[model samples]
Target: MPQLEPFYFVHLLVWGFINLLIIIYLNTKYILPRILYIYLSRILISKL
Candidate 1:
C-alpha cells in the first residue's frame, strides 16, 4: 500500500474549526432570529 500524506490531516482540522466558527456566528447573527420570527408569526396567525 502507498503511504498517505500527513499534512492533509492538519489542513482538515484547520478548516473544520473555521467552519464551526462560521456556523456558530451565523446562528447567533441571523438564523435564530429568523426562525423565531417565523414561529411566532405562525402562532399569532393561528390564534386569530
Candidate 2:
C-alpha cells in the first residue's frame, strides 16, 4: 500500500491550476470568439 504525502497534494494542486489555465486560454482563443460572433450576429440581425 502507498501512503499519501504532502508533496502529492502540492503536485496535484499545481497541475490542477495549470490545467485550469490551459482550459481558459483555449476557450478564450477559440471558443470565446465564436460565441461572441454568434451573439453579435444575432443582435445585428434583430436590429435589421
Candidate 3:
C-alpha cells in the first residue's frame, strides 16, 4: 500500500515519539502528583 513508504514511516515514528514524550511529561508533572496527593490524603483521613 502507499502507506508503506519509507518517508511516511519515519514521519509517523517521529510524531509518535514526540507525542509519547509529551504524555509522559504531563503525567509526571501534573497527573501523578495529583493522584498521589489524593491517595495520601485519603489514607491520612482514614487513620484519624
TM-score of each: 0.65, 0.85, 0.88
Q: After superposition, how far is residue 34 of candidate 3 from its true place, in Å?
A: 0.3
Clashes of each: 0, 0, 0
Off by over 4 Å in 2: 1-4
Could you tell me the TM-score of candidate 3?
A: 0.88
lDDT at 8, model 1: 75
lDDT of 2: 0.95
List, residue by residue over 1-48, the lDDT tens digit for candidate 1: 234556777789999999999999999899999999999999999999
Q: Using lDDT, give the best candidate's number.
A: 3
| Decreasing lDDT order of the candidates | 3, 2, 1
Per TM-score, the best of the predicted structures is 3
Q: What is the RMSD, in Å, between candidate 2 and the native fold over all Cα?
A: 2.2
- Which stretches of model 3 miss by more than 4 angstroms? 1-4
lDDT (10s digit) by residue, model 2, range 1-48:
246687799899999999999999999999999999999999999999
Better of 1 and 2 by lDDT: 2
Q: In candidate 1, residue 36 scores what lDDT?
A: 96
